[model samples]
Target: MPKIRQVEIKSCRLETYSSKICVPLPAQNLPELLSVAQKLKELTPDLIEWRADYFSASDPKEIIAALEKLRAVIGDLPLIFTYRDYAEGGFVNLNLELRAAIIESVLKTGLIDLVDLEWQTKVQVREQLLQVARENKVSVILSYHDFQQTPANESIINILKAQQEAGADLAKIAVMPQQRYDVLRFMETVLYFNTHYAEIPVVAISMSPLGMISRMAGSLFGSAITFAVYGKESAPGQIPIEKLRPLLNLMSSP
Candidate 1:
């Protein structure tokens, strides 16, 4: 197998093909957002994800102001900006054009280290947003989520490849598993991709309670990042960061 590559952001280093815990902040207001960030700092998550879509304010200025406050509290910790659409189990409902504009505006702020863009976004709009992100020196994490069911291994692999081809610095896929084999297939696909294509980081998640093991054991199968919750779960199957941190450390230890 080829050697895997690591992604560095600020003082944090995400080691190649290893597990890094990410805590999602789903606050609806600035006060709540700062409170969450302050608390998670003690837990020591490798990355902090701001679920911007959940914020009650839709104005870009308000969102940026909130992010600035979040950055102040977190300091040098890597921050990922995610504005998930409603179709992908996100709380907020936004039109495609509006969503693209919001992401573009956020990328220009330079406060975030990584930005998460949905793989299903319109091609022209996606390219435009990616260009802006690149101009600002921000890494892009192209993501695909299936809240319904996990697809076949071939389909999963295709999605990962598509993200890489579309200029993503990291590729992420999260699927709901109906059976144990579905989770296994997801892991197998990730392992194959990481072993063969090591240029970009891959984040593979199998959602729902049945797939919790996938979250904990991601490092063994080449998943570079795993999402954990602190107070509220941004996704269906997230383990709390406090509990997940120790488990990930134990599993990833040499």
Candidate 2:
């Protein structure tokens, strides 16, 4: 299996299973976003992800303006563009095609380092997204999210395997654990995928309060990228970057 070639952004090198600490920027106002961006620059997060769905509008002009501001402040740091749809637990109201167009425009700017493409999208849409990202040299993170009950262990592992085969630089699976057993099952899949499939880096996480430990302990089992909120959390159980930074660092230590 093919793996993501080690790549460097700013000074961060993604080698093997290095942890990427991302701070989600979810401001609803553009001007307010700039202030938050400045703060994020000060923190110098490993990656900055924009929940474009949080914006008041999804127009290309608005997207361009936002990316430009991020590029200006972020310099060469990596940025991940994600406008999650309502069905997939996002606030965006546009049709899927319009969303894809917005992402295509963002890719053309050469501003973002990666784009979070949902695994649940139509096959045609996924193909087009892969093409756009490839042409722009942006990495595509094929993501799967189950806000409901956690799927069985076999199902989760198959999803990761399928995502890797789908030409993704990284694979992300987020599930909501209903109980302690659910959390253990989620981690078991992470460990199996990480050990058996050395090519793609797997991001396995559980949501809700019961799933908090997975966020802090992911690095131990082989999760490469972990999401941390900067201002407001886009998900149910996201720990703030400030708090997550220390905890994740402690966990990553040998």
Candidate 1 achieves a global lDDT of 0.88
Error of 1 at 74 (Å): 1.2
TM-score of 1: 0.96
In Å, residue 196's CA in model 2 sits off its true spot by 1.2
lDDT of 2 by residue, 102-143 (tens): 988988888888899999999999899899999999988899
Clashing pairs in 2: none
Model 2 / residue 39 / CA error / Å: 0.8
Candidate 1 structure quality by residue, lDDT tens digits, 139-184: 9899999988998888888898889888888889999999999998
Best by lDDT: 1
- Give the least accurate 10-residue stretch of model 2, judged by summed lDDT: 1-10
- Report every candidate's CA lDDT: 0.88, 0.83
